[model samples]
Target: MTTAQIIYEQYKVLPKRIRQELKLLINSEDEAEKPFSLMEDIEQGLNEVKLIRKGKLPRRTFADLKREMNDAK
Candidate 1:
């Protein structure tokens, strides 16, 4: 069997919570190498910065997050 098959066999025997954690780890590794729609936003921000050497995307302030939470309730 391949190494992945061996690992899959080992993973199948793990506890539910352990399996979930392992799944997350595997997903994160996969995400790092894969392109997704969310990454397009990141790439757009990078492109925006290139247009103006000193420009950067605005970050959400803590107060803004707090206000948003309050509004949601």
Candidate 2:
């Protein structure tokens, strides 16, 4: 079998969440070559804001974010 065929066979057996993550990874590779879109970013930010307002996601402070970034480094 070809490399892609082998990958597909393995991909088929993955759980739904993992398959979704893999799809995102694959799409991100393609996106690397594309120009940045401010509208797309605005839409994503709006969606996150909606989720946060609904209490589906926790709100985070800039200090907490900066701390996490510093810790990562």
CA lDDT of each candidate? Answer: 0.84, 0.95
Q: Give RMSD to native, each candidate.
A: 10.1, 10.9
Model 1, span 1-73: residue lDDT tens:
9999999999899999999998899899998987668889899867876765655555557899899999999
Q: For this target, which candidate reaches the highest TM-score against the unseen true structure?
A: 2
Residue range with the least summed lDDT across 10 consecutive positions in model 1:
51-60
Best by lDDT: 2
lDDT of 2 by residue, 8-67 (tens): 999999999999999999899998879658999899999999999999989999999999
CA deviation > 4 Å runs, candidate 2: 1-35
User: Candidate 2's error at 15, in angstroms?
Assistant: 43
- What TM-scores do the predictions have? 0.40, 0.52
